[model samples]
Target chain A: MITSIIINGILIGLIYALLAIGLTVIFGVMRIINMFHGEAVMLGMYAAFVLFDKFGISPYISVFLTAPIFFVLGSIIYKFLIDPIPAREREITSLIITLGISFIFATSAMYIWSADYRTVTLPFSQDVMVFIKTRIGYPALISSCMSAVMIVGFYLFMSKTYMGRAIRATELDKDTASVMGVNVKWISIATFGIGVVLAAMAGGILSPIFYIYPFVGSNFVIKAFTIVVLGGMGSVTGALVGGIILGVAEALASTFLEYSMKDIMAFILFLGILLFKPSGILGGRTRL
Target chain B: MFFKILSSVLFLLLLFSQVSYGAGTFKIGCPAPMTGPGANFGEKFKKAYTMAADEINAKGGVNGTKLELVFEDTQAKPALAVSSAKKLISSDNVIALLGGWSSGVAFAVAPVALDNKTPYLLEHPALDDITRKNNDYVFRLQPTTGMYSAALEDFILKVVYPKEKKKQLTVAYIYVDNAFGQGVAKYGIIPFFKKNKDKFNLVVSESYNENAMDYKPLLLKVKNAAPDIVVLTSYLTDGILLAKQIKEVGLQAKMFTGTGAGHSMQDIYEKSGKATEKYFSSGPWHGEIKDANWKKWRSAWEKKYKYVPGEHEVEGYVAIQVLAEALKGVKSSDVVKQREELKASLKALNMKTIFGTVKFDNFDGYTNQNKAYKMTAVAQWINGKLLQVWPKEAAEREPAY
Candidate 1:
């Protein structure tokens, strides 16, 4: 039982880490928390559901379809809604606009789907792997692996590519990047799009692992924010580490204490960490 | 010219009065969650209410007035329910109030009925206090948590354990931490445990929020405890999530049971696939009730709605039937007198309906709780279909596993 709890904790942590990476990247460049981050996750889940419902494609394959589509949707949203406002009004304006966008997305999904809770039983949904008499869900394990791959891939893209360099430059200092001919506007839009793509990827992988509802993304949004703060708001590695810590902590708490206390304990720990660090675990590191 | 103008004004007043009073259309206010988390059931209840109203109108309206069921969307919130109830009473000028899916929503609207002296008929809420508060107008049809728990204890002792021939019983009770879930689990299990401590041991009794997306940690605990039966009290989505997780976590038990929310739903059959086979959910209203009128009504409903009857559908149909019975025999067109008459009729009524005899008995501090032996049916999922398993007379097939 102890071994299983440990394994489940790590697996849950990895998935959470993937979800947080999106929020962290978006916040890193935009400096505006996308209130609709959860809605992006919902979109990914819904995309996977549609693929399965309409075309009989596995969510595993639908992740590829959803990521690109999410990229385009995210870019379109930023261009139409977030780009119109001046920098002075961007913070509060983006918050209100994205909140409205969030409602539009959720209410649209509800209207199209009629607020029904949807779940898909994949061929491997019930598959399990046994390790030291501890059974682990293979779907969950697959999701963790997928999340890890995405995080690493995201890290590489942000570090190695020319566009990645431009994005980081803009995130550091938009005026400086503009003086260096970085096309800061395009970088901002593309970075937001990439952040959304990453969120969709995480959502697609976790779709079969959880119930799909119009409001499902909101459940993960809070956790993602916690991970962003825990890992240091803009730090890639921090999000990963924070996610693992939070997930494992929740697993242990639920196992030892009351199950309902898992989330509460996580938030308490988050507040404690913020009370001391203020900036976050790696806030002073000065590097992603 | 003055006489002609005066005569025309008199005609206008008389016409308006006839339209308002002589129309013979009695409006009944109702609130259900039509757009929020409870929309699935609320829409189903709406359809049932419409069907019942149509049927009653077809069969020569109640005392020459067609019953008009005015449904308002509560969104399953207390504040919204209270607002809708107030609007339904004042704006709509409904003679009686009916319908609510949650206890909190029902309780929110209870005051409106009490203050206005309108007959409050509830279909989904099962909280004992909704009817127990000595409110003359409030009448509930759903079996209370206490009543449901009593049935569970009776079945567990008399039929389930003996039929399985288990020397001892260990039950893992996982329920949604809401008014309905906690009320029954807290009140039901304690008394049953005290009475039969030698026979049954409650290994796990935990409550989780309804929006809970994960159950692995809780299921892991249940696996370690290794209870004989895994009993869950949850709504639709969480029920499916928990059932699937139960299989994934490999929580082995003699049998799996649920408290008539998601486990008893058609969604479970469609969504959970084979994971739900042999699972049991206890509640009132089964598709296979075998009652003659129920069969006819179910057939008519399927033909009209092109789907099987959900719990909300069944309850809506019965509550309206009860309301129609209460509304019968009003000779005057006065809405206030009609409200008083309906309340009295509902209080004194002892008649058979699809849900058994519709009678509200004032007992044990409750002013108008139906004492006509509320039968709670235990429906078991077998090969993707749910059939009544407990109360052997109502069981279409024996429960497996």
Candidate 2:
């Protein structure tokens, strides 16, 4: 039972990390929390749903379509909404603007889809892998694997690519990077685009396991925020570690205590991190 | 300037024309959650209420007065419901109020209706206290949360228990933590177990917040307990997720049942696919009545909505029909006197609708409660369809268990 709980925790944790990475990336580049992050994920879920419902496409394949579309959407939103704000007030103004954007996204989705809970049930969605007593659903396993691969690919891109280095330089010191010919503005746009694509891909991965709805994004946003804070504000490795810790903690709480205590335990851990380690596990170090 | 003056005059004429049109109509205020989590139920209430109103008007209207339904979006929040109720009563001057979707919203709006002395016909919102508060204006068409599982208990005792090989079966409950879910556990499932203590042992009772994404840890706990029966209470989204997760976690039990709410929805079967097969749900029954009127109404509803009406939609339709029946004899110039007559008519209501025999009675500390309705039915999902399986006469199929 304990082993199963831990395995389930790890599986869910990886997905949580994928969700938080997008939020962290946006924050790292722009120093502004993208409140519309969850809504972007919601749009991706809907995109997957429409593709499946209309064209008989699987969410796994739909991710390819969703990623690029969301990248463009994110870049356009940044250009029109985020980039217009003065740099001094960008943090506060962008927060409010993105919050509004989130509302618009959610309400528009509701208007179009009518608040119905949609699901994509693949033939193998329910198939389970059993090793001794530990059982894992195929969708969860596949999503976790996809999340891990994306995280690794992102990590490699950050460390090895010239654009990735330029984005990191822009994150470190925008003025210095601008003087050094890094094109900070373009880097910021690219970073925001990449961030949104990650969020949308996470949504595509989750479409099979979770119910898709207009407000489904709200269910995950709080947890993603918690993970981003816990892992250190802008650290990719921190998000991965933080997601695992929180997931395990919640699983343990649900196993021993009441099931409802799982979320309470998560919040308690969040508070503990905020109080005891305000910088987070990897806070102050803006590692991709 | 002359065109502006003429347009202003026309606008004033149009406004007065609307006021004159209002004099020939009797309005019922409907406070429903039209755009929030409860919006699904709200949409159903809107459709059902409109259909009933249209039908009444098609038959030369109620007492030759056109029925006008004034709808206000409550968003299923108490604060919004109260405001909507106030607006409906004061501005629209509705003689009666109908359609409270959630219990929290109902609790807030019920008092406003009472204060205004308007008859409030509660279509859904199953908390028992809504009717038990001695609010003279409130009358409910759907069964209270406590009564939701009455038919399920009967099915279990008579059919499931007798067939079980074990001498003492174990039970587990996993429900959403809310008024409706807690009410079912407190007043329904727990009492049944306490009554049949010798035959059943409740191993665990777990409650989780609504719209939670993960149930694997929770289902794992239920799996470890290995209860013979698992009872659940949830809305549509959570219900589908729980069903899927329960299957994913491989929690084997003799039976799994849900007490109304999401489990009773057809979306569960469609969304969860094979995960929900043989799952039983107990609530106000619909879709399988033997009456010709019910058949006609069902067909009409399907033709209009492109889907079969569920328990909530049926309850909404019945509430309107009941209100229309009560409004039939009321003919008075005084608004206060008309409201009083409507209240009295509701108290004395005993009619047959497609849903069931509608009758309100005061019994067991409940005021203006519909105690005579015997329509709570348990249904099971079998072969991608929800079919009534209990109350032998009303059942379309035998219990799959």
lDDT of each: 0.81, 0.87
Candidate 2 wrong stretches, greater than 4 Å: B1-15, B333-337
- At residue B158, give the lDDT of candidate 1: 80
Q: Is the docking of candidate 2 incorrect, acceptable, medium or high quality?
A: medium
Task: Return the clash pairs for model 2, or none.
Answer: none
Model 1, runs deviating above 4 Å: B1-24, B163-167, B329-337
lDDT over C-alpha atoms for residue B16 of model 1: 91
Best by DockQ: 2
Candidate 1 structure quality by residue, lDDT tens digits, A1-288: 777887788888999999998889888888878988888988898898899989999888899977778989999999989998999999898989888898899889998987778876788888888877777777877888888888888788888999888888888899999999999888889988998888888888888888787777778888899988888887888888888888888888888999888878788879988899867788778657
Task: Report the C-alpha displacement of residue B21, candidate 1, in angstroms.
Answer: 10
Compute the DockQ of candidate 2: 0.75
Tens digit of per-residue lDDT, candidate 2, span A239-286 = 888888988888999889988899999999899999999877888664
Best by lDDT: 2
lDDT of 1 by residue, B170-255 (tens): 88888887777876676565567667878888888888867755678899999999898777888887888888889888989887
Question: Per the 3 Å backbone cut-off, how many clashing residue pairs does candidate 2 have?
Answer: 0
Model 2: per-residue Cα lDDT over B1-401, one tens digit each? 99999999999999899778777888889998887677787888899999999999999888898899999998788998999999998888889998778888888888998999999998788888899999999998778888988888999999888898679999999888988888888878888898999999999888998877788999998898999999998888889999999988999999999988898888888898668899999987883489998889988999999997778888888888899999986879666788999999988888888877778888999988887336789989898878898899889988888
Model 1's lDDT to the true fold? 0.81
